[model samples]
Structure formats: C-alpha cells, structure tokens
Target: MKIFEIVFSPTGGTEKVSGYIADALEGEPVAVDLTDCGLGFRTVAMTKEDVAVIAVPSYGGRVPAVAVERLGMVRGNGARAVLVCAYGNRAYEDTLVELEDAAKGAGFRVIAAVSAIAEHSVVRQFAADRPDAQDAVQLAGFARKIQQKISEGDASEPAIPGNRPYKKAGGTGMVPKATKECTDCGACATACPVGAIDKDDPRRVDKKACISCMRCVAVCPHAARAVNPIMLSAATKMLSKACVDRKECELFI
Candidate 1:
C-alpha cells in the first residue's frame, strides 16, 4: 500500500522520528512538506485501499498552528491513517488528539497511533541523536506488527495516549533573538518553515506568525541567534525531568 508521510519538522528531529515509522511500514513515503512557504490548504484524495502516516512534532505539547493550518489541504478520501506524534521528551499534550481530529476531518479512518520522542526542537541537551539505532529497531518491529494487523484485516482504532482534557502546555516564548554575529545573510528567513522571519531582514520576526520551531537557531551560519535568557532558564527548570529520562519511541498497530 502507498504511504503518505506528512511532516512539519524544521529542526529535522521530527522528520527523523517520522522516517523511522515510514521505514517500518515498508512503502515509498511521499512527504507533504509543510515547510514550503507557499504551502496552503489543499486536498489529497486517497481510496480505502491506501494508508497514510501523518506525523508531526509537538510544538509546546500541541501541533504547530502553522502545520495544522496547512494540513487542512490534505484530502484523505476515507484512507486508513496512523497518527504519529513526536515530542521532545517532555510530553505530547493535545497533539495526538488534534492530529486524529484533523485526519478524520480530512476523510481518513483512524486506526493506530504512536507517540515518539526525539531531541528537543530548540535546546540541544535533550534526547539527542534519537531515533537512533535502538529507535530504528523498535520502530521496525512496530512496523511489522502494524503490517500483520493490516494483513489480518484488523480495523479497530487503538486507544491513543494521554488524557481527554489535555494538560496545559505553555510555549517557551523563546523567540531566538538575532545577535551581532548576524550578517543579515537572510538564511534564517529562507529556512523558516512557517515563514515567520522576514526574508529581507533576518532579525525581524513576526511573533504572531512564528511557530518558534528554532529553524533559525539551528541554521544560523554564524550562530547568530539566541532565545531570551530568562525564558531559557525557566524552560530548563521545567523540562529538566523530561530531559533526564531519555524518552523512547513507541508503536501501536
């Protein structure tokens, strides 16, 4: 079966986690790049015979608002779907449920779901190099189980993770402020997945438009970007436990 892999990863951590899930499924996964600035709502029609793996990173325990906005373009046509939410070791609050709703609204039949963890999108200390060898092995086994379920004609929806009323997940509000090192090279603006940074002036960030995916921080050639120090300190204390546990990738079939 054809597997459509939809993702909105700016730091590549989410993409890596999604890759493992797609690899496990044994199909050529086509990426629906929400990173494209020109991206907007569009529909993708799929028949009952096909399947889709919808994956996204947990932005502050929720789906990136920009990603959610863009996902409205997908037309599932009642295609069976597996919702996969990858988080940065902290938690996936409403992200999974939101994705489930989005897929259903797009005409996809919800089947299984997974909540995996990767490195923190902004900060580098948590769960680095994740979706590593161990993660791949786990994901491969999970894929095999999912395949088996499909072959056995099991169509029941699995119990998704987390509570009904999702916990409050606050944003870091860590807008990466540009530093003197910035040459106004415009790379950060160009690489911004949500088009948050203005192309002409890299330092200028549209806070309302910014999803704070940290693409600018990661891609800065001169290490010219940084988040507010106060926010970083606050986030560090809040996420310390999460960083210590080294969360793992999960699978459900």
Candidate 2:
C-alpha cells in the first residue's frame, strides 16, 4: 500500500514532527504540502489501498482555517488515515478531533491520532528545540504501533479528544511587520501560505488575510519581520503558565 504524508506547517515545527512519524512508518511516503497555495488539493486522489498521515499545526487550540479549507478539497476515497496535531506546549484541544472529522468527511477511515508538542511558532522561547530526542522516541513508537494496526487490518475509528462544535475560533493577533532591514526580496511573499504578503511590494501585507503563522518571519533572510515587542511580551505572559511545563505527546489507536 502507498503512504502519503500530508502536512500543513507554517514555521516548520509541525513539519518536523510529521517527518519523524512519516519516516518511522513503512515505505517512502509521497508528500502533499497543504501549505502550498498553488497546490490543487481537489485533484489529490487516494485509493483504499493507501494510507495517509495527515498532520497540521494547532492554531489557538483549533485547526487553521486555511488548512481546513484546503484539506476539504482532497478526495480520500476510503484510504486509511492517521491524524496528527502538532502544537506549541500549550494544547491541541480540538485540533485532532477536528482533523479526524475532516478526514472522515473527505472519505478516509480514521485509524489513529496523535497530539505532539513543538516550539511555539511566534514565541520562540516557548517549547524551544522541541520534538527533541524524547519526542522523537515517542513519535517513533507511535508510528510503529500504527503500522502494526494497519497491517492487522484494523480500520476502527479511534476515539479523539475535543468537542463537536469546537471552541470559538480564536486569533493570536500577533502580526509581524517588516523592519528597516527588509530588502523587499519578496521571499516572504512567495513563502506566505495565504498570499497575505503582496508580491510587488512584500512589505504590504494584508493583515486580514494573515493568520500570523509567522512563515514570513521565519523565512526572512535579513530577519526583517517581527511582531511588536509589547504585544509579544503580553502574549508571552499570557502563555507562560500553559507553556512552562513540558507537555508529552499522546497517541490514540
């Protein structure tokens, strides 16, 4: 059976965790980048003999709207799916459940789910250098177990956490702006998953469209993009309690 590693990672954290799990699974998996705005997700088709490791980052305990919209277009065609939600140390409350629902809706049979921790995309200090050695070991174990489940023909839907309605969608409002060092290279614009940055003038960002995923900030060669200092401080304080303690990855079979 073929394996597909489908992921939506803004600042590379989610992608890191997804990579670990995908590597631990059976064969070389085909990659489907949900972050690519140019990708036509609707054209993605999978047969029953395929398995998909669908991974996405948890934005404020919920799935990113852009990811949801793009994932909706994929046709799973009865493929077995393993849902993965990667979040900063805080929490992934509804992400896995929402992803499971989305995969089911897309015609995939949900077999397993995972919640993993990654460095906070905005607050780099929080959960820094995560999916570390410990995380890798745990994720690898989960992958092996999931592979065994698949081999055994276990197609039962796994029980995932979170509510049906889901928490009211929340926003971080931590938009990054270009600093004096900005070279107008347009790298940020090209890398922006939502096309929030204007191509001609990369500095001109559509605040409304920006999810504050920090893709632009992370991709900036000159380190020109950053959120306001005061806002970042306040956000740091707000998340301090939730991020202080190390959170472990959880697997559902």
Candidate 3:
C-alpha cells in the first residue's frame, strides 16, 4: 500500500511534526503539499489500498480555511486516513473533528487522529521549539501503533473530539507588512500561498486576502516582513495565559 503525506504548513512547524510521523510510518511516503498553489488538488487521486497522513496546523482552534478548501478538492477514494492537528500550546477545539469530516467527505476512512504541539506561528515564545526530541519519540510510537491497527485490519472509526457545529472562527486582525530591511526581492510574494503579496510590488500586500499565515514573514530573507509590534505584543499577552503550561501529544485510534 502507498503512503501519502498530505500537509498544509505555513511556517514549517506543522510540517516538522507531520514529517516525523510520516517517516516513522513509511520509509518514503509521497508528499502532497497542500500549501503549493501550483498543485491541482483535483488531480490527486488515491485507492483503497493507499493510506494518507493528513496533517494541518490548528488555526484559531479550528482547521485553516485554505487547508479545508484545498483538501476538499482531492479524492481520497476510500483510503484509510490518519488526521493530525498541530497547534501551538492552546487547545485544538474543532480541528481534529473538522479534519475527520473533511477527509470522510473526500472518501477517506478515518482510522486515527493526533493532536500535537508546535511552536506558535505568531507568538514564537509559546511552545517554542516543539515537536522536539520528546515529541519525536511520542509521535514515532503513535505511528507504530497506527501501523499495527492498519495491519490488523481494524475498521472501527476513531471517535475524534469536537462538536458537529464548529465554533465560529476567530479572526486575528494582525497582518504583516514590509519593513525598511525589505530588499524588494519578491521572495515573499513568490512564497505567499494565497497570493496576498503583489508579485510586481513585493511591498504591497492585500490585507483582505492575507490569512496572517506568516509565510511571508518566515520566508523573508532580510527579516523584512513583520506584524506591528504593538499588535504582536497584545496578541502575545492574550495567548500567554493559555500557552504557558506545557502540553503533550495526544493520539486517538
């Protein structure tokens, strides 16, 4: 059976967690980047014999809108799917359930689920350097358990947590802008998943289109793109209480 690693990681944190699990499960799984704007999701087709490790970052306690949209386009074709939601220390309220629903809709059979921790995409201090050594060991163990379940032909659907009607998505009005260090190299524009940055003028960003994914900020070679300091500080303060305590990875099978 083929194994596919399907992921949407804007700042690389989610990718790191997903990669560990995928590696432990399969030697060289096919990677399907949900962040690649050039990819045609509709063209991605899988069979019942294939397995998919679908991973996404939890954005505001739920699945990111872009990820949901992109995932919808692919046909799972009855593949067994393992859903993973990587979050910064805060709770992943509806992400796993929503992802399960999405994968089921795409013709995948939900077999397992995981809630993992990663460095905060915006508030870097929260869960910083997560999916660390400890996380790696935990995720690897989880992957082995999932492999066992698949081998045993367990068809029981995992009971993932979350409500049928997901909570209203919270908006982070925080948007990044170009700084003096910006070299107008257009790297951010090229890397932006949503085309929020103007290709011709890298400095010009469409706030309405921007999901505040921070791809631009993370990809900027000159450290030029950043959210307003005041806004970042306020956000950091708001999240501090919820993000302070160390959280561990939880697996459902």
Writing each residue's lDDT as its tens digit, candidate 1 over 1-253 gives: 6788877888888778777767777555666777776754474556777778888898777777777767777788877888888888887878888888777878888888888877887767777777688877887677778777777878888866665566575654678879989999998998898778888888899987777788899889999999987888888888887678877766655
Q: Global lDDT for candidate 2?
A: 0.91
Report the C-alpha lDDT of model 2 over 1-253, residue by residue, as the tens digit.
7789999998999989988888887865799999999998999999998999999999988999889888889999999998889999998988888898888888899999899999999998999999899999999988999889888988988789899899889854788999999999999999999999999998898999999999999999999999999999999999999899999999899
- Residue 39 of model 1, lDDT score: 57
Please give the CA lDDT of all the candidate structures: 0.78, 0.91, 0.91
- Residue pairs in steric clash, candidate 1? 42-73, 44-75
Off by over 4 Å in 1: 40-43, 168-172
What is the C-alpha local distance difference test score of candidate 1? 0.78
Q: Per-prediction TM-score, please?
A: 0.90, 0.98, 0.98
What CA RMSD would candidate 1 show? 2.0
Look at candidate 2 and tell me the lDDT of residue 136.
Answer: 94
lDDT of 2 at 106: 89
